[model samples]
Target: MDTSKVSSLEELKDLDMDFINDIGWAKVMWDSLQACLKKSFLNWVDTVLTMSQNEDDVKEWRSTFMEQFEDRCYELVTDIRELHEQVLVNIEKYLNKTQVLCKMLQADMPVIGQHKLGLYQEQFQLKRQMRELEQMVEARTSEVNQLRSKQLELCKNLGREPILIKDHPLPSLNEISDLKKHIEQLEQETFDRLEKFTTVKGELIEIINLLGYTPSTQFELAVITGEESDFKITEENMESLDLFLYNMKKELNNVKEEIYQLRTKIEQLWNMLDVDFVEREEFRKKYVGDSLNTLEALRLELKRCESLKRANIKVFVDRLRQELVEIWKLCHCSESVRYEFRFFDSDTYTEDLLELHEVQLKKWKIYAEENKDIIALLNKHHTLWDKMIELEQNATGADRYNNRGGKLLKEEKERNLLSKQIPKIEANLLDLAERYQLRYGVPFLTFGNTIESYINNLHANRENAKKLKLSARKLQKEATAINPSTSHMTSKRILTDCPSTDPKKYKYTPRKVFTEPKKNPKQLQVPKILLTTLSKSKRLSVERKKRLDKIRRLSRQKETRDSSTYIEFQNDLSNRVDLRSTINVAVDNETVVKENFKSPARQRGTTPKSVGKKSPNLPNKLTAVKSQIKLIF
Candidate 1:
């Protein structure tokens, strides 16, 4: 119940006062006002009752307000209380009055004079306004009449006369003859002019086409009107036309030059074809028949040569194979030689042989056995040979050096010792030389080869130094070519507005989380060493290895025992053997022999001393029996 909803009443007190006053009135309107005021007051009372604090006040006031106002506040309500005493008297007095006039409605019974006079005055003013409006309309109508008359006069002056309809009549023959003659003259002149125009149009169209124009469409023709046809040939336009013609002529000359160039290019292409293809064709025709015969002969000759070469190669291969087989047998590693021999049976063996003989003959010509054991032996022999050569050269100067007393003798003794080793060195060098000569058909120390070998070997270090210099130069060049610009990463902090702290407000901002990629450690390949042999007692010593191993085992056992699923009873009783520590049991007869060398000598000579009688309960000593058995093997 809002107080603002009380649209009619000012206040609850005013509403009650109005109600009481209306009840106090004696006139007929008093009842109507009383009813309205009562309704309004009741509405006000209902609204005030809904207010929170004045519920009791609103209820009591609504219930007693009308009665209290009627009884105590207004005279009309007192009259209503006294009306029962006077109601019949007033009704009788009003019924006794008979003053009446015949009237259709009570309001139309007029008795006034000034009001009728005012109506008359109003009608007179309205008539005066109507008269003024009529005079203005008549003046406008007269103006319209005058304007129409002037328009008709203007029409006559401009010669827009009304057409006069007349009865039909035939044209005169003389007029028709004159018109026909005029038409004839017009047609002839038009034909002659059209012929000239057509010729001009054709010329202009040709020029336009030469300028890369097609014929005009309807819209284009309309835009460039037909009257422009005469303007195209005028003296003023002739200079422009001449310029266009000049451009066309220039273009024509340029096209001619292009044509000439194209013709030259074509001629050059033709000449190329004629020189290349025609000569080839002529040669083909001339040689095709003779070449066929020659080819047959050549083919036969090539076949013979191939057969000879194959036979020679086969012989060479057979000799090499035998030598290689012997070498393999000497090496006691025949598997490699057998693999190389298998190549000889293949179709590509000839290619392989050619490659090998061309490039690798020097490398493989030496027998593998000679190569393997000869290097160290040859080095020893070469040292002795060098010493001997030095000594011999010194001996030749020994006589001149006799100024020193015992120097000559000492040198001679040294020379003799070196000379004694010469036979052995010579024997080895000769054997190697012979083997090389037999395998490669080349002498050991040809003069040209020795000189070339000395030159190449002596210059190897120099060449390496030169190559290093070139590589350094190239690296410098690359370093100079590299760009000097370097890229750098920088960070910046920017300041901006931030929300102030308040209990009612919260603000959010993004936080950038930059995570670096985690780098994992690279895995390494563990080295695996395969141990071949060991003594039986070596196995026991390896268990006392690293101190950390015991700690690791104990920790692992503790972890297992602490697990929820582990059972104490389930522990394995046996010790697990480490296979890496297992001893490989093998008996080396050489080792055994070496170990028991004295034993063998003793067995062949004297027997061990023994007691006279042994205990019957004890078993006989088995050492001698085992030793005897081992010796027999």
Candidate 2:
């Protein structure tokens, strides 16, 4: 009975016949018009507002309207009512059809057009749109189903079973494209996994053979070999294969670890016994492989070393103590730090004491390794510092200013270089220490004090020394002014005259000066005339002929050898390709310089220059080649 849903005369059949008769045709028609007009702007038919009561034409107009009511209003209203009902019926039919199709297709209609939105005439166009929507939905649905079937086939091949696909109810393009991409991805993954499986199985078999072990499980056998096995290319099977491979690798690693430890123990014993490099190398070559027999031999050697160690425990203990001291010195340990290990100072040469020393030595070695970078910078700083102190001590010498053999000038340059480097290294150490402390939540220590404290104290002492030197210079100047007679007897020797380490002696280079490997100049192309000697009549000189032949031979050699992967097979046109770069470049680890997100630039003078670094992404040292070349004009 809902007027909006009623589209045909048949829909009214549910009401009793008596009920329809009770409502007369005129009344029914009037009610129907009201129902149809309910979808329009104004629902009721009313008298015109311009009919005046006193005008003579009013009566005439009223009579005219009354006379034409049946033809002009009633007839037209009835016909429109019938036609609109048909339009509704057609629209409802198409809308229902589309809804059913979308529900079955499991896709959504791009839009569900509103009923009664357009005029009666426009209903035809709306109905057409609904039908077109239905057709598109059906076509896409069919395409999706076909794709799903293909996907299932792919899954079976890969031993994968995916859940049934239920595409989103609204979008079309995304689903179709996504499904296609997913199928392609699945195919690629399957191929890659199969290749990986083959490789892993092959490696597993080799490792199993190397370890001389047998596969107890049928799955293990299947993974190692492909015949008559129940292996599937499923995730479960892949995990199983990976696990078995991992266990095999773990076993191999354990064996290797044992071999390495044995070698280390032998090495430690060799050092204790003062064994020569030749004898050690021979031992290494003798027991080269990590086999059971090799392990047994190593065990026997360790036992022999143990007995030898006990026989001369005192000497062995001394060597252990010496090794400990070397690590301690590198770590810049104070004397008190060294004294903590009483076992080294003990007279007792028991195995327990020897083991304690070994443990202590091992502990310090690990600590040194963990802090090796900081240790390296500190070592450089200390070396340069010591050199500076030597230069200062020699500066006070009465006759040190003589530049005989340019020795004084060389020393002065060396001193200046050391002065610059020491502070630079210290600054690096400070920054590295700050990072270490922040990360570890403990102060970086050396010589039994925080490195920060040490650096600060050194800074204070350096300033004080400078002040003292200035005062001494001032006193000397005043004295010279007072006694001009004695001034000529003495020379005003500057820090440039400072004495330094012996120039004749060789020293290890720290700040190595080296450029990038030089590029070879372009090859000189020979003229075509020179290459062939146009006519042998004016015969080419013997030297020219020989050069041409050499060039021809070289060109052929280049063509043949260009793609060779062998290290020694050939090289570029450069004669000294084998030469090494002596430069020690501090490479940025995992360097992928990122663009800094722009914020307001920091105020120029608000932060201390020493406190705030310029940019986090900037290279630490400018002298490093890569940094210099990468950022320079």
Per-residue alpha-carbon lDDT of model 2 for 268-312, expressed as tens digits? 888888788998888888987766567778899899988888999
Candidate 1, 246-355: lDDT as tens digits: 55456555554554444344333333233366744553354332222433443443454445555456555555556555544443333644565456444444746844
Lowest-sum lDDT 10-residue window in model 2: 588-597
State the displacement of the C-alpha of residue 348, model 1, in Å, after optimal TM-score superposition.
29
**CA shift at 249, candidate 2, in angstroms?**
1.8
* TM-score (all chains, Cα) for each model: 0.13, 0.42
**By lDDT, who's the top model here?**
2
Worst 10 residues of 1 by lDDT: 486-495
Error of 2 at 495 (Å): 31
Per-residue error for 540 in candidate 1, Å, reads: 64
Which residue segments of model 1 deviate by more than 4 Å? 1-382, 396-406, 439-633
**Candidate 2 segments whose C-alpha is farther than 4 A from its true place:** 1-197, 216-240, 273-283, 291-293, 296-300, 307-312, 393-396, 406-419, 439-442, 449-633
